[model samples]
Target: MGFNMALLALRNDFKKWSFILWIVIIALSVYVFANWGAQGKIGQPTSVIASVDGDEILFKEYVE
Candidate 1:
């Protein structure tokens, strides 16, 4: 009975740590993604060369 109680406590602790680890992983992923594509623009207009109807065509797309 004592061994069972210890095992149960260990399992609960493992679950708690797993939850914290997942939370940390998600937060880090969000932080990285938020900053991933923010390095090039310094308050400049995007590379759009033309607009048709209401859709703007990017220069990169035109080149491709």
Candidate 2:
């Protein structure tokens, strides 16, 4: 019975630590993603795909 109680306590501690680890990971992921998105690359084109009427259209513009 004593051994069982200790095992149960260890299991609970493991679960608690696992939950905290996941929370920290998710928070860091969100932080990185937010910073990346704020760079204004969402609609900007990286390369020209085609030219029509002497006007160049970007790959990003074509996709959107």
Top candidate (TM-score): 2
Cα lDDT of model 2 by residue, 10-44, tens digit: 99999999999999999998887677668764555
TM-scores for all candidates?
Answer: 0.59, 0.63
How many residue pairs in model 1 have overlapping backbones?
A: 0
Please list all clashing residue pairs in model 1, or write none if there are none: none
Point out the worst 10-residue segment of candidate 1 by lDDT: 37-46
Clashing pairs in 2: none
Backbone atom clashes (below 3 Å) for every candidate: 0, 0
Tell me the tens digit of each residue's lDDT in model 1 across 10-58.
9999999999999999999777666653653334445657888988776
Using lDDT, give the best candidate's number: 2
- List where candidate 2 sits over 4 angstroms from the true fold: 41-45, 48-64
Cα-based lDDT for every prediction = 0.74, 0.79
